[model samples]
Target: MLKEDLKTVNEVSKLTGISVRTLHYYDEIGLLLPAELTESGYRLYDKGNLLKLEQILFLKEMGFELKQIKVILEDPHYDMQKALRKQREILRLKSERLHAIMALIDEKLEGDEYMNFKAFDMKEIERAQEEFKEEVEERWGQTDAYKESAHRTSRYKKEDWQNIMESMNDIFKALACHIGEDVSCKEVQDLIEAWRAHITKYFYECTPEILSGLGDMYVMDERFTNNINQYGEGLAQFMDDAIKYYCLNRL
Candidate 1:
C-alpha cells in the first residue's frame, strides 16, 4: 500500500473520534492492530485496518466484548457483509422499540389509562431478553450457570418472565433510591442481597463469582447500564459497587 494511503494512530483517532488510549488498548489486546509500523516508529493503519476497526466498533455497540470481537474477526469463515446485514436488522428493531417507548411515554403524559397496558406488554421486552441471552450464550456458553439459566428460562411462561422483570426493576429502583449513600451501608447491602436472591430464585444459583461478574456487566454493558440508570442517574455504577461490597463482606 502507498505510504500516503496509511493513517497514523493519532490521525485515526481524530478521524474516528475514538481515543488514542482505547486504540492502543485494542492493539495490545490483538482486537485491532496497525497495518504497519514506519521506520520512524509511527503506527500506520491502511484502509484494511480501518475496515476492521469499523467492524470492531459495530460489534462493541452490539455488546460484544473485545475478546468476542477478536474471535469473530479471526474466524476464517466470518462474513463481514452478512454480519453487517444482521447488525442493520438488529438496529432497526431497536429503533422501532425506542419509538414505541417514546410513544408510550407521551400517551401516559396525556392521561391515557388504556395505553398504559402497552408499557407493560412483554412481547418486545421478551424478544430483547432472548436476544441478550443469545449474545451471552455466545460469549459465555461454557459456564454452567449460563447453560442452566438458558434451560430454566426456556420453560418460563410469558407471565413468569414479565413478573421476573418487574421484580428486578423494583429492586433496581429501590437501590437507586440509595445511590448517594455508601455502598457498604446496611440498606444498600441488603438491597444487593435481595438482588442476588432474586437472581438465584428465578434463574440458576448466583454464586459470589457470578454475582461479581454480573455487577461488572451492569457497568460494562450499555444495555444493562441504560436500563438500570433509567431509575436514577448513576444507579448502575452504585449497584455494581454495592454488589461487590456484598460479595466481599456479606457473602
Candidate 2:
C-alpha cells in the first residue's frame, strides 16, 4: 500500500463523524483495529480498514448493536455481498414506508375524510429487520466457538444445569438491585467483571470481545431481555450499559 493510502485516526474521525474515543473503544474490544501504527503510536487506517468500518456502520444503521456487528464481521462466513443484500432489503422496506406515508399525505390534501394510521405501523418493518439480524446471528452461532460452548455444556447433568442457571440468576438479581446506580461506577464494573468470568468458567472463553456481544444480546435478544428483566424492570438494559462501559474502558 502507498503511504498516501493511509488516513490517521483524526482524519478517520472527521470523515466518518465517529468520535475518536469510540474508535479507540472499538480497537479495545477487538472490533476494529487500525491498519498500521506509526513509530510514535499513531493509528493509520488503510482502505481495507475503512471498508471494514463501512460494514460496521451499515450494520449499526440496521439497529444491530456494536457487539453484534463485531461478531458478524469477525465471523469467517461474513460476506460483503450478503451484507449488501440485507441492506438492500432494509432500504426497500424503508422506501415502501416512505411511499405509503406520502400517499397518505396526498390523500389528506385531497380532503379524504378517513385518517389511515396504517402508514405509521412499524410492526412489519421491525419484524423483517429482526429476522434479517437473526439470520446473521444464526450463522455466527454455528461457528467453532459456539460449538465449543455447546459441547462443553452438553456433558452436564440436569442438576449441574440447574446449578448453572441458579448461579447466573443470582448475578442478574444482584445487578437488578443496583439498577438505579451509575453503571460505570467501580461497584458495577466489578460485577461486570464477575459476570464475564462466570461465562468463561462455565461455557466458553468469554473474551472481552465475546462478553461485549453477550451484553448486546441481553438487550437485543428478546429471550434474554425477558428473562433478565424478570429480576427487575429495566435490569437488562442497565446490565447492557454497564457491560459496554466495562468492555470499552476497563477491559
Candidate 3:
C-alpha cells in the first residue's frame, strides 16, 4: 500500500480524539491493529482500521467493556451495519427516557404538580437496557453460559460457597507461587487451565473467549485485582499475564 494512504498512530488519535496511549492499548489487546508498520517502527492505520476503531468506540459508548468489544469485533460473522443498528435501538430507548424526564421538567416549569415523581421512574429504561444486554448475550455465544451459570450457582449452599472460595483461593495462591516465572511455562499454563476448569465445574462452561475476558478483568477490575492480590502481592497482574499467555499461546 502507498505510504500516503496510511496515517500514523498519532494522526489517527488526533482525528478520533482518542489518546495515543488508548490507541496503543487497543493494538496491544488485538482490538484495533494498525494496517501497516514502517521500517522505522511507526504504526499506521488505513481507512479500514479507522472504521473498526469507530465501531469499537461506538460499542464502548453502548456500555460494552473492552473485552466484550474485542470479542464482538473479532466475531467471524461480525456485521458492522447490523451491530450499529442493534445498538441504535438501545440509544432510541435512552432517548425515550430522556423525553420522559423532559416532560417532567416542562410540567414543573408550568407550575403543575410534580411531586408524584412518576416521570422519574427508570424501570422502563432499565428494562430496555437489560433487554439489549440479553440481545447481545444471545447473539454472541454467552446466553447459555449465563443461564447455566445461574442454574448451577442457585443450588450452592453456604458451605458449598465457602468450599468453592477456598478452592479458588488455592488456585490463585498456587499461581502466585510462580510469580516472576514465565507465564507461558508449563506450570503456569497448567494452573491457568485448572482455573478455567474450576469455573466450568462450578459455574458454567468457561469457553476460551470467556476465560480470556476473565483474565483481562483480573487487572482491569479493581475488585477482582484486590481479591486476587490478597493471595499475594502482584498476583492479579501475574494471573492476568499468565491467563493471557495461556489463552494466546496454549489455547
C-alpha TM-score for every candidate: 0.46, 0.53, 0.49
Top candidate, metric lDDT: 2
Judge candidate 3 at residue 164 and give its lDDT.
70
Q: What residue runs in model 1 are displaced by over 4 Å at the alpha carbon?
A: 1-139
Candidate 2 ranges beyond 4 A from true positions:
106-113, 142-251
**Whole-model lDDT, candidate 2?**
0.76
What shift in Å separates residue 173 of candidate 3 from its native position after superposition? 1.1
- Give the distance in Å from residue 246's predicted Cα in candidate 1 to where it truly belongs: 0.9
The weakest ten consecutive residues by lDDT in model 1 span 70-79
- Per-residue lDDT for 26-79 in model 2, tens only? 765556767556889788887767777888888888677675676566443456
Per-residue lDDT value at 201 in model 2: 81
Ranking according to TM-score, highest score first = 2, 3, 1
lDDT of each residue in 199-240, candidate 3, tens digit only: 889877888888877777667655346556656789988988
Q: What is the Cα-based TM-score of model 1?
A: 0.46
- lDDT (CA) per prediction: 0.72, 0.76, 0.73
Q: Please give the TM-score that candidate 3 achieves against the real structure.
A: 0.49
What ranking emerges by lDDT with the best candidate at the front? 2, 3, 1
lDDT of 1 by residue, 1-251 (tens): 45798899999999999999998877655557565557796778877677778888877776766666665553323456666776676667777777888898888799887645554555754575467547544655565565566566556664574577668778888888898999988888988888889988876788888788778867765544655676789998998888878888987
